[model samples]
Target: MKIRCRSAVFAAMMLLLVLAPGVSRAGYDYVDISNPFLRKIPIAVPQFKSFSGTPEEMKRARSSSQLLAETLAFTGYFKILDPASFLFDPQKDGIVAPRINFKNWTTVGAELLITGGLVQTAGLVEMELRLYDTFKEKLLLGKRYKGALADQRRIIRRFCSEVIYKLTGHRGIFGSKIAFVSTTSGNKEIYTCDFDGYRPHKFTNNRSINLTPMWSSDGKWIAYTSYAKGNPDLYIKNVREKRGTVVARKGINISPCWVPGRFELSATLSFTGDQEIYLLTGRGKIIKKLTNNRGIDVSASWSPDGKKMAFVSKRSGTPQIYIKDIVTGRVRRLTYEGKHNTQPNWSPKGDRIAYTAIADGEINIRVIGVDGNGLIQLTEGQGDNESPSWSPDGSLIVFSTNREGPSRLYVMTSYGTDQRRLLEMPGEQSEPNWSPNIEGP
Candidate 1:
């Protein structure tokens, strides 16, 4: 295939070409992510065949293939087959449909197969990837991409997104990001990383205490509470522009959560003597008070449709989660099993809420249905796990835990399986907020 480019100094635009014709998206029902007793599908990933014999081309071929497998395996849906047990050889066998041996893949119990090919010349890379169904001996998805050599990770992620959408009918989290607070520079500051905890960089250099970095519904802005000016204040800044508005009222301002599909957010502002949640515009203008109770109310999590909100309230003598109907102004307690239930995060599907619950001097993560039934504890006996946040698709939850050592970010399936650490840095990390699907560089 012929690859074209406009500029060498600037990053080249990736070109995608679909090789398959008239494939129905609904034809594949390999995964039902909502099922609790889900069995992982077995998939195989082999080294890509390099078209050029140069050492640089072979290095890219080996690394890109492994990166592809790692990206797909990060999702708890797949069991990547060992490359050492592969029967088909990329050096002698074909990476295309006509030349692939289906029996060789099926013999190793591979339900799905992926093959890749690489071509590099003059600092540009061209990749052709294909996904196959081993049993049916059919090509499920195929794409060709051409871009700069530096765009290897981005190119692989784009292909992985395509592969996930082909199987699950929903776009993957490869395009999303996670924001959290870290003490890497001897001060609490906000940092952003990719969904798989890659490319973590400091987002704020406030040189003071920063907490609860919340992403806007559009993913362009972040709101967090910083003590840079000597008081707990809410600062809303554009992620790329580094310009924002500050809500530096008389008292404390914290726990900012964005409303679904809107520019408004609910935050705990204590300009008054009492701590309560209030609705505010994107620019720090207060629209109205959302809660009014003698007990302290804060940490508001909105429903998917913005018709209701779930928050923490001490009105019932202890901190418990409560749900409020935004239309009729009716409040009802959602959690009664725990006295110290805080940090409630509503699911993207609006059917459940995940929160931090403290019981018997142990803090763990728990999820209960919206109707206050089916309470299940996710973490136990390891260490304190707090600040649970849901992925955009509601298939996974990211939280902070001190299970091994200092607090670090961890991700698990929605059903509380495949728990693993996401990233490690110089200091503790906490309060991870997952962002929505973003489309850009």
Candidate 2:
């Protein structure tokens, strides 16, 4: 695909020299620590134990172990062991003292084991967990994570994340959610789903066009571009409170992203003389001017640190990705590998940036380092793969592709494995953005 850049080649070169130092490296913050090529290890989880409370009072005690197993297994790691087939009773000490039979677990090709116990004291719940290395016959990580009975699931998610971190030294995204634009009915709407593409429940029932949804760092609200009243407008949706509000109702205000520190949001508003990026406080106060280019400069995504920004610019004649320094207000193009690259989505870890590339008239999702190196193409030969969204852990990308049939949600590994389609089918979905599952947004 051929990309048309309005900025002259000479002009782009000159801009690079003067603006290179000014471009803030503050925009993308998701760190790339996971190795996609490594094979996942086998693991075992004996249902977590309980000491004081009844099985029912333990809340997630009975299912917490299974949930952890499934969560780790779905991540392409830890082939879990089935307790029914094991020699030991998984729930033996589940309601009391828990002990693991290492030999029994090793007999079934298990390398790692995870055990825990739930204890309720004076109407409060507390939990203890232990991870063991079967071969070494020693405890790998044994620590007690205590939380209220109401927070057992929360404790489980955190413990599971800790296990992943101890094993790979990289944070896990098992508890994250993906935010995307789904058109289930005749009208386009915004929806939220798990990172694995499961439990895709709709959040917006408005009969309007909403696109480019972004989550705040706090994960309390979601900012999206909607055209309910008429022209494209920006709206914020809170997950827990189940509240939605219009941030920008007039002009072509789109690509709303929250700046770090929760000070304000950075968005593009055409209400100005032309389309340019601006920073607005949480209360909708314009704080600063981000871009001054006469060309189409929009889609500003903040780096994890909130210092620099990565946005799509036509200043180079064709649409290409560029990184700008916030301190001095200079810019440099990050993508020169493909033409017509747009929709630069920054990962939470601040490691990789996913975008759409036009090749032979086909749009395929691709990823590259923020420095414009280590370019890797994830989708090839699909109908048209666009809107590459990163899982909060930077493990996979949920994108929409018109493959085999119509435009449906397709989830792929960050390194492009298990290219599976989500949903049974029958509608058009596009522009997926994954959110950290801390709160709502």
Candidate 3:
């Protein structure tokens, strides 16, 4: 009997190995780059040159160049170069001989290169962009646009989308903003700003800590946690509004997340003495209880279909993420390799859940499949990267990292690449909520 049991276990392990390449791997890292199938290659980006434009127009070009570099870098395949690291200046034809030496560029470890410049034409400014294949010594993309000096942001963003297509076969999300919480001001407050930390707006004025901020389907309203009235309370505020409404009851109203496919919310409320995940209607009424008692069930994340939920609980002693069906109340454990796990945020397409797994009490976010497979850790050696929110397109994830000092915003791909600091506001911020791509006001 014992031999048969061991044989069955070995067979199961072999089957899992064949099904999930990264699951049960020895080491945990942001990406499982073991099964390399000609994954996207890296590229080098240099700042674009600007000439014959207004002082303000020149500044806009420079800023647009930075944003464009950032957008390509976010795609996870580009090994972006720092503009300061470039020994060669970015100049156009007649300015730097117009002939780029491919050998010089390829020697610098650049597989692909991008070049562009902005010039003043009439009362408007003209932006010209060119992407090159250093190996082929040919231009991959070339385009020019004419727009007002102040339209630099949109024009450059269009140019960036072209860059991403030239490399990753897709467009990039560069003009998006993430709403989250910050505690650097001695207390946590709700804030929403640009993806690159340009224009920040404070949402909550109370001197209390906030957590679990979730963006509305429309990307305008922000639902979050506040202790303003004592005990954790769930409050929803419009990004542009004169007031906010209490969505849930007081006392342990933790981790409210937006429910996909509908205007409802799924949250963990502990009013019954122990935490349990609940599905609340859009109007703040309890539609159903998703979990029973016996454990501290929290951190409920809804799949894109809103049919299933992923959450963490103390049912396994420490904490482990669990998935449950909203219809039949059937439950399943989603993590076994990690001893400590929490905060499971479902992917936009519902393929995986990104959660925090504590290694010796230090927390780092990791990703896993919906059926407790493909456990891939996304951060290595960190202060904390607790809550991870996926972009509407499932291409990017914005989370908080304390590795580099105070907790600030960081954005990376679903496969984890090109990690970059996203915000440096006046206060500590975390629990990022990446909204859907809604048209700006």
Candidate 4:
């Protein structure tokens, strides 16, 4: 979809006045904000002020600020300015309000500035963060967070989410997590880590092959296909409690996809001699059969509203993406350009669907509109890239690629920019699933 740009002259003038409380004049035009081809904002983040007396407390404060700056830069929305060339010292120029020297920031070519202070009280820590628009000299947002000393990462992520909300009217996905199948332990197991690829935790250790991990909408459970009992069966793992249960089906149980807002799921089962989609509850009771095609049907992804679904099927000559209407039992082909198109993941915004396409002898990532128009290729000129999954906000995509030798995970913007390696592990990794925004640590 295309969006019109606003007048540049008017946007420049809006930066000169003091914006109202809780209102932002950050010069972001929502009409064109969805366009991924725009330039990123330039932001400056100086060291946070420490109000503690001990050296250990001061060191913790500095590290906390650096973590926040790294998180913002990883979003691909802001270019962090180096502190060595800063014209003004945050300690001397002040951290908030009238004490800030807006001219000093503007002289350094920074459009936005972030300032904060950290202090230790008793056994806990308190932090205050603020975002400022340098040209207009306006405070875009201000908030305070209090928690234990070990909760600094969570606190900073919450504040960064607020800054994104003020600028783009949408919450950021910094606090989210990603789940994928990893062979780091010499076997394929389900593992999860933070969105920035830190602190990886193993979810399944059955010593057998596990594939296709899918998170529930509420972020409480993960459903995947495992071979723990010597059969290809579906199992759901409680994320918090670290417990697992088998779905207990007849044959070839795989590709489980949870409905948007309920405890039900749609998965592929081969009990009837052919792979087909079936709706089931969280506890493993079958609700109804979704597809009865003669060819193989698998990998079902639901739309945002839960009324429609996209899946891979071989009803035609080769495997391709197909869309099905739940209400009327109507099916239509959704991909035609490529001979092999699979792993279709509907975006959270319900505008586009991302999948894997085989072109020029390589598996590349591609996206197509809901109506099967505006097809765009995202990855090319390297090894295979497959299993595309969208972030909660539909602004980013995470997939696995073998372009760098061993298969490893990667993340990029929706428009295929800022593509970078996500994590470094020993063995091959694939089938990444981005989780929803988790509420707490």
Candidate 5:
């Protein structure tokens, strides 16, 4: 079979440098993310100015403003203020710092404000965006971007990343992708979508049973188990090059997980008469056997620092989560309450691991500390929630759930709050693997 891959070469947007650095009083400490009961910052984003005043410009103006609001709100950090409640207008009033009125924004209990102006030409758009501290009455961030009109979302996302970093001291998850298994094409094939579930398209079209799409650490490759041939073999394909290698061992090759900051990965191979995890190179060469247990040992999840791995083992009578020190070869059980626990995913922060457990005939998601202390359920009584994957920033967890109906992708805060559906499509989706942030804008 031939794999078709299309790659986009993004030209850097022209940046108009007119921002003053030390004008705003607010600093990086604006939002304390560590707070369990963090308050959502109220932000007012009025309609962007249509400098051309043409119908096309006006249409994009409204859509772009709404997209900006939605993008920021998706971070679970901001509350978008209604446009009807705004006292100032983008058309009549000024968007610049000199001709702005901060009291109008602060009066409506908005601590932050974002204003934009857009101009469109034949095929390109030029936008100027500004973020302000309403109480301090100063410009916090300002930038001008020029790009194709179709690239409006990317331009807005770049600005949003800057907005988040200015406030949170960390770049937000704006350009990441999530890969999962879906039956949309009448078979269990691999599909991918943008971080917020936009632009979902099939990643694999083999019309076979493709499962567990795992992204490499560099976001350049994806390793998955495919029954395209006869047996369950591991296929590692470079997402951009359209070429790959196959690890068709003797019995079975499954559960491929990449090591952090390296070209190596670990997968469970049953070729040795017993299922065990083995570390392999990116090109599919066995480096060493990672486990030598009598029972089945699979589903390897690596810690952020690559010092430890958390996997599922049936060595303790029932399937449970276990952590292994890569250096010392010391293994310890992490979960004991559940009879069936699997699909362990280590958080990027290296503090917790999320896994799926079947309790009372119900499958749900749970998070446990690295030291096996704090065990809390993230989803319950909601239909089966399985395959929990953490975002690169460690702020959110994406998992597949059947709470409403057929299994679909859902995302929630790390603490399991603000649970919401990620996307809707024709068929069921499961086993989502989130990619790291793409290289550039």
Candidate 6:
């Protein structure tokens, strides 16, 4: 298969060298930190300085600064300092290292600070960002980024990823994207947005019903089910190229799940009169059938090691989650508490599987251990919560809820704390799939 290159509106020029001036303590390792006991870091982010001598430059600088602050706060690790309480005005203060007042920030209860300067020249914008450890009074990380004036969000997110990497050993998911199904345009279509729900744009304009947007293991392609040709057919679309190829089959092709670290996928097909799961290549060539049950079987989620799969089956006369071993073909029932349980998402860390279960006449999110022990319920009284998808790092889960009004996407930690809505849009959003962190240049 030929890979298609997707071009953005702006080009990024990232500097290779990063300057860290003084000795800094080893930051918190999130991999070792448990979700329930982790504490948020206190940090301050002031408005970026403007040097372009134009009103538009000043406005852009302020927006970029706020964007950076929000991105950092969204990580669930940082407590952003309010700008109204700052002792020194970031707009009036100098942004260079020599002119920074560490005491001013430290007195305001900021353990860390981020300051940057933005300048727009011709059609391009140049940004210089520096992260500071106020207690130590030393520069922790600094970078120079250049891009189009319209691409300020991307530039800021790039720097934020660097800051996360310097503080935590792993890079942040700032560059990762979310694929979802939305009904904003009077029809169900696949749409995508940034990790923070910005830059939302439609991926498929087929003007037909689309469902279950799943990203490939490599994040290059998105597989979804579309009813454009009168039947539910599976389609693989190159996200950058904005084109799709249908996986032609006899019957319904729905609920496609990619095998970890491979070019093949497992999906539910109704070619044999009843829905069953089958394994296929990236090009939709049938490799083998995984489920041979007479009842309806769908929604396949691959384990991290590719040794097992968790899926929804009705073989017991009710929808429930079941795990199947790929080699031995041994099927084990995982959920017996909920009357209707479905949409099992295997965690990327290989510890737990998150799914949606109906209990007390409401649909809620639940998680169970891989060994069928330690079952925990995440959501209780919010609304009808369904379609729980785990983040690439397995630290957070993004699901949809209709509690407030229309259905909107929400993100919560893996332990079911900090439940916050992700985006507020016009249409109903569902089936959120987080992409793997795509490395930026």
Best-performing candidate as measured by TM-score? 1
Candidate closest to the true structure, highest lDDT: 1
**Candidate 4, number of clashes:** 1
Assess every candidate by TM-score: 0.97, 0.76, 0.78, 0.92, 0.95, 0.90
lDDT of 2 by residue, 308-377 (tens): 8999999888999998888878899999986699888887678678888998888888888988889988
Model 3 TM-score, all chains together:
0.78
Tens digits of per-residue lDDT for model 6, 1-441:
222222344333433345554435445452345652266777989888888657888888889889899988887778898988887665678776678888888888898899988888766777889988888777778887766665677788888887877776567677678899899999999999877788788888889899999998789889999999989999988778867578868889999999989988999998878888999998888899999999889999999889999999999999999999998999999999878999999998898999999889899999999899989999988889999988776767899999987889999888887789888777999999988776561
Better of 3 and 4 by TM-score: 4
lDDT of 5 by residue, 1-441 (tens): 222212223655444454665545465567787852267889999999999899889889889999999998878788889889898767789999878888888888899999999999877788899998888888889887777777789889989988988888778789798999999989999988999999998888898799999999899999999999978999999998869999998998999999999999999999879999999999999999999998789999999999899999999899998999999999999998869999999998899999999999899999999988899999988889999999888888999999888989999888888789999999999999988897543
In model 1, pairs of residues that clash are none
Task: State the lDDT of candidate 4 residue by residue for 254-357, as single tens digits.
Answer: 99999999888999998878888999998878999999988789999999899999999998989999999999899999999979999999999998999999
| Residue range with the least summed lDDT across 10 consecutive positions in model 6 | 1-10
The C-alpha stretches of model 4 lying farther than 4 A from their native spots are 1-21, 24-31
After TM-score superposition, the amount by which residue 53's alpha carbon in candidate 4 deviates from its true location, in angstroms, is 5.9
Ranking by lDDT: 1, 5, 4, 6, 2, 3
lDDT for 339 in candidate 5 is: 94
Task: Please say which candidate is ahead in lDDT: 2 or 5.
Answer: 5
Clashing pairs in 6: none
Q: Residue 28 lDDT in model 1? A: 47
Q: Which lDDT tens digits does candidate 3 get at residues 217-265?
A: 7666677887888878787666666455675564587777777757678
lDDT of each: 0.90, 0.71, 0.69, 0.84, 0.88, 0.84
* True-vs-predicted CA distance for residue 79, candidate 3, Å: 2.3
Misplaced by over 4 Å in model 3 are 1-63, 81-111, 121-124, 134-143, 146-148, 242-244, 248-250, 272-274
